[model samples]
Target: MEKLRYERPVINKIKAGVPDKFGMSTRINTITEIEGIPVKDIIKGYGSPVFVLSESKIRDTYHEAYRAFSTRYPKIQFSWSYKTNYLDAVCKIYHSEGSWAEVVSGFEYDKAIANDVDGGKILFNGPDKSDADLIKAIENKSFIHIDHFDELYSIIRISGNLKLKAKVAIRVNMDTGIYPQWDRFGFNYENGEAWNALNRIMLSNNLELVGLHTHIGTYILSANAYGIAASKLSELAVRVHRKFNHHIKYIDMGGGFASKNTLKGAYLPGKDTCPSFDDYAESITSAIINSEIQPDHLPTLFLETGRAMIDDAAYILGTVLANKRLTSARRSTIVDIGINCHWSLMIIGH
Candidate 1:
């Protein structure tokens, strides 16, 4: 007879009158393999605390998101957010999928260029752009999303000095009924600040107001918020056309679409609670289509989805270091992974 397999004995103290949250199933799910490779074998070869990314998953996710938007909107463009994962291979995958580069800093802008992404296809965003960065963006003919009046004036000066029309857009922040509103980055929409910035840009004559951009917030749970943002951006586009007789080329709804990751203190898993790609696409596209903007002159819809696109495609493998019993007889398990692992998964809840 074969020897009995060794098993670690576990004892449980049951508390009466308490029900398990996961009905009938108390065992936690275990990840044994990824992309047909055994986890143990991978760990044996690469050691513990290794990061693994699935190329196929990344491509598939990109296609899924692209299809969601492209099928709904007449014209749609996706600019891969560089800050999410600036790894060369990751960026190349997106670029191969026909995504433009959306960088938030000078380093990312350079990374996009190094990746051979056409400078014209890069969308430069963020609030800390240096004067040199502005010059490079203008020289490359990239679309620069102005975050404040100072950046706006800097771009105007750069364009005047270089004698090149800087293609630009104003980053608009609005009240989308989300808590802890992200009012720090861009011009506010409600208090007429966004319109005021647009007026200044139009008056400058050196900068071409190419688009209207807004990123409501991150891990945005409400799809209706995007609809509201789309409507507001559409209103701005219409106003710009009417006032200056110049059609805005695009409306960039900067990405904050939530990935399928559970948030702390949540009753339901994020996989079940988060809005699907179709849900977001429908909300945004429908609003723009139903807006006051003319159908024939509808601006191109641009998305810079980052977390939702790449989060699920990557996983960090780590070993459990030790297990011990606490003073209350509760089990405590320590793993090799640390806060560093959590950095990449930021905005994506565990």
Candidate 2:
């Protein structure tokens, strides 16, 4: 004989979240694992508050991005932006994936060299290059992206003193119809500053114009803006070839490609709105390929995307320290990690 057990009735409360236009809550599914490893196991092994980087994911992402551009353009070169992550392991992973180094500081340049990156393959870019940095870059024959006239002339002077033809390029800043234009870093395209800088580089005996570079803006959702930038840089390349009979080695579309992070006020989900690798490839490649530049003399396309490449590969794993109700009656969880630091240098960049 079986005895029937008395059961207690349980009540459940369902909380309604704010819904979007279609009346669907945009709640994201929680992550339970990364790369087939359970979060519990990972925390158990490495402890919470540790940063985990999936090497497999990094290689996969690099290959995916490389494929997106390579399938569209014949000459495409990818450089790892050292400021993003720049952990020796991460940098080595990218370098092993055939990405050259794109450094914005003497320290990064040195780190790249220490990583056994060929000095000639490194790209030195930024507004601040010390005299010592210039000498090292010149000695190494790295691609020096000139930020201003001061740097251009300084490189010319240094190169002349060293009796070496420094491989140089001017960073062209253009109005790509994007808000908060990044006009402060390089020469302006609309106001003839870019052209003037090109002419100055062409006129220098100690400097060889190797490329034309432009970094429009960051987190740009518009693919057409990249098309505009590509077209302008291509036009500049054509003009340089037509005027000086010197073909530039590459067109560096300095990376500002947005990662899939929704802004504070974004109505649409980032996955739905942000441009994909294919979208950017189509825009930039199509514009350059269809430009007035001769087909035979088309320059190499260089992409140095950072955040988009490494964002998904690594994560800061932190355990919740406390659950508290604020005076405003809002619920919040305090985590172990503070934003004040990292490998320290990972957060230190331009």
Candidate 3:
């Protein structure tokens, strides 16, 4: 017969209403599994400190977010941002759900192509497009969001050289009553730079102005700010039609929707405080519908939100590595993984 393994005995103490800083817990609920799979089995199959992405969770979140916007707006399109979560599995999941790839760099642009996203569907954004990058975007007929005059000029030159009409948009930055405005990339709407860029694009024979884009801020907590942004973009679209008789095809409200994660030092938890998808959809859709833009030519709304869609669908599973006895006889456990979480980040062993 096999001998039984030796075990170390330990003392324990229990108290009623033992509480964490956030609140007291009547029961210490544990996450042993997700989507019907045992957590221990997953850990054993993969390894300690592994990233687990729930496919069903990802799909469910996508459907919820998509429905929130599509049900409210006449036309809506979602583009999954590579910067948000580029894990191939994650990207594929989003792509399968009718999302185009929104990339900000040459490498990421290529990555989208590699993932078999149609060239015309890819949105090329950011301020750092190289001549080569612009050439590829022009060749692919991708939506190139011009960030500044230099990039605009580059696109014009590249498209002229290629004899191709590059689908394009101008990224407009503005004071949307949000502090520390994102005025770094794109033209300033208040200063008439955005108009100047639009005029320049309309004059260019090789560039087709398809849309107006804006990324107000990241982890934005206010749904009202999105309404303000939509109003501003709609006004620009109406002006485009008035001046050049050109109705822009779309308005890209680059994503900044907050995930359910509390900011450091925040008093309230994120789950209770973050704006809902409905809140944002109501704000943005109402603004465009109420704007001066003609109802017959209302532009398609492009949303690049990804964080809120994925935060709840993925998690890091880890195990405790060692235990040390303190001078006061208290035990301390340690783990390999490092993280930043809402409450204190402590590792646990299975």
Candidate 4:
């Protein structure tokens, strides 16, 4: 006779209260496999606490997002954001898919160059670009997104000294009906600071303002917020063309497209609550198309969507380390996966 399998005893106490709003019992499903491979087999071979990324999923997500925006806008380009996941394999996959590199620091810039991405295709963005970084970017003919006034002056001074014209864009921060505004990274749009910066750039002989960039916020739930942001940037572009007679090359709606990850205090799952790519594309494209800017002179749409593009393509596999009962007799299962496994959750406080 076979020995009886061991099992842990679990006790539950029903509390009297309002039932779940959805009128459905919450169920926990067990994940037994991933990408046709058994989870246990993978853990046996590679050990626990491993990360698995699906190449097909990445391509699918990218094409889905591309289709969403390209169908609405005439010209659209995607620059894979490096800060999201800088693993060489991940970067190469995006590069192979015809994505330009969008890096936020000197190290990431170098990584993009090392990955054989065309320097001109790279969009350099962030607040802490060093003089050396600017020089390298200028030499590579990269599109440097100026973050603050100091960076603008630094780029101007460097370009003047090198006798080279720096292809650049100014990062604009504006009110998009979102709370906890990210006004620290770029010039304010409503207060005329962004316009002032553009004026300064236009007057400079070495700096050529080819584009306008803005990243409203991260994991933004409202797609209308993006529409408002696009409208403001489009207005600025029209103003620039009117004053300088130079049409901007592109309008970079910087990343922060929300991924399908549930927030901490959410009423529904992210899959049900988060906006889809098509939703976001419609909001942003419609705003630009309806703006005062001429249709014939419409600029290229550049998106640096990071989280929404890659988050779902990757999964971290871990094992249950222990099970415990709290003082209130609540059950808790501790897993081997560390905080690093779900870094984005920490970022969004999920």
Candidate 5:
């Protein structure tokens, strides 16, 4: 019998108005294969809804971010943010690229340690840090970014009692003309809170203030905001140097870089609209390079970007289990993957 060659008749009326945003025609960007293995072959072997991460894309994005900073600034460090995607494979890829671990929780910290990240290289940042957590951080000689006064006091007491000096930085929150400012996470820069926090840390002999940290917001499209943030951090660094004669080892502009996934109500697609690595590099590096801080004293730049680095490389491939018609006859796809499993998928579709 002759084989039947059946193809789905996909037809639609051509719409007008905005041209192709990506400058490419609207077509199915299908993934027929991966890593020399056909998609069908993979499905036959593993099953549907299996996640397929492209090692190439992961390395490429990491290189992109690394190059952006390393080329612009002399000293730069990238700490892989754990909360973004703690998959062992994903973390290993980043670690292999020489990225230190940037974890937000005790669990993530433990995971980083297990991943073979050096204790001194791991950066501990978050609002909630248990007593046991502080002890671990101090003992391991990790860089702890203090979020609140209570945490600072706790760390000081722990350091004093244990006779151990803890390397630390203050998470400073600044307004950079962005709505829904992230003031809750760190000490405010405009207000004297950040200064006050710095003073307290400096006064404590057990706490070695090592750097300045700030994460303005997430999915931030405004590159200029980074410029403003960098300027504010530089100002703090200069003030600390002038008064206390202390030079921080680094300045951390914590990750808020948008991934290639459109946010809800976003007019332009993120892949096209989101600021590129170059844009972020320009804003942040320019501010630091232009700051009054001496060139020789320019602290290392640390980026805690997680989403932008791994979102594109990781894909949740799911088979269409069922297709139903909506009330308006629009198509609704039910795949093997759900919202819980593929949180980033919803962001892309939006």
Candidate 6:
């Protein structure tokens, strides 16, 4: 018997008068290996459709963002957004790196408590909090950001029932020059709603307003928008201090930092276009520092960035299933994975 050999075929075609936009010469950059291990070996050991998360990458990204902020600002805290890749392993990694859990529901709060995170360190933000959830959070001393008037009254009732003062903040929704502004999370700043909430919280005996939060939008490309948001929140912080003689301990400009994932309709690759940690730090830090709030009274900066910190570290591995020809003689290949598994497909065009 003779051994068989493999060969690839090639063809040449004549050039036309016009060039195809999709026919630009592209270099195929294959991901042959990851973290000193061959991707093939990983697929062989773990099988196709396996998700491989790089522990080193996760730590590096965490350290990168932490360093970027810590070096610029004196007091900075990172709270891992539990909704973003809530796998216990992933959450533990962030916790080990000194991340406090930022949860929105009772289940995530339970998970954080189970994970040994200090209850005082949990920052609870969301619109849907049950009476029982409020009771638990109040008892645990979590920083709860209020979303609506109904929730505010509910917390007051719960505080009366439990006889415990709840540490809370009001989520402010403002137009920071970003389109499709995030107005659903908190009270509107421009319409006096945020001030109304502030006054109500200040007068309440059962609730302590400890911070101010604003989440402009997600995947925000404009760094200036963050500067604007930071200034606005600082302005409110000063106003709150002047009127109520109460100081906000923290100003949480909620996370929407762009990650390295290319968004749909992006002209340049995300790696090149996404703002760096330094850019964001400069934007927000400068605004807060220049605000009327005293330098010594500068509130702790809390960041809940999720996707920007972990997306690059997570990779979905799958094998090519088959290739088929289209009506236009174009070839398309299918993979073992689909949109459900790798949710990052939302940004990348198929």
Q: If ranked by lDDT, best first, what sequence of candidates would result?
A: 1, 4, 5, 3, 6, 2
lDDT, each prediction = 0.89, 0.86, 0.87, 0.89, 0.88, 0.87
Give per-residue CA lDDT, model 4, range 1-350, as digits (tens). 55877988766666343336653234345787776778777778777788778787888899999999999999999999999999888888888988999999999999999999999999999999999999999989999999999899999999999999999999999999998899999899999999999999999999899999999988999999999999999999999999999899999999888899766555567788899999999999999999989989999999999999988887777889999989987788899888566422101000
Give the residue spans of candidate 2 off by over 4 A.
1-29, 341-350
Each candidate's number of clashing pairs is 0, 0, 0, 0, 0, 0
lDDT of each residue in 197-245, candidate 3, tens digit only? 9999999998899999999988899999999999999999999999999
Against the true structure, candidate 4 has what lDDT?
Answer: 0.89
* Tens digit of per-residue lDDT, candidate 1, span 80-142: 999999988889889999999999999999999999999999999999999999999999999
Residue 139's lDDT within candidate 1 is 95
- Give lDDT tens digits, candidate 6, residues 1-350: 54765635535365452324544223235797877777777778777777888888898899999998888889999999999877787888899999999998989989999999999999999999988889999999999999999999999999988999999998999999998888878999999999999999999999999999988888899999999999999999999999988889999988899998766555556788899988999899999999999888899999999889988987777888887778987666788887577432111111
Candidate 1, number of clashes: 0
Lowest lDDT sum, 10 consecutive residues, model 1, at: 341-350
Which regions of candidate 5 are displaced past 4 Å?
A: 1-11, 17-28, 342-350
lDDT minimum window of 10 residues, candidate 5:
341-350
RMSD of each: 4.2, 5.4, 5.4, 4.6, 4.4, 4.9
Two-way TM-score contest, 1 vs 2, winner: 1
> Is candidate 2 or 4 superior in TM-score?
4
Candidate 3 lDDT for residue 71: 92
What's the lDDT for candidate 6? Answer: 0.87
Residue 295 of candidate 1: its Cα lDDT?
Answer: 89
Query: What C-alpha lDDT, on a 0 to 100 scale, does residue 349 get in candidate 2?
Result: 16
Q: Write the per-residue lDDT of candidate 2 for residues 1-350, one digit (tens) a residue.
A: 55877855545345364435554343545676777777767778767666778888788788989999999999999999999878898899899889999999999999999999998999999999999999999999899999999998899899999999999998999888897788899899999999999999888899999999988877778989999999999999989888989898899998878887656556666777899999999999999999988989889999999888877776666677887878986666798877653532211111
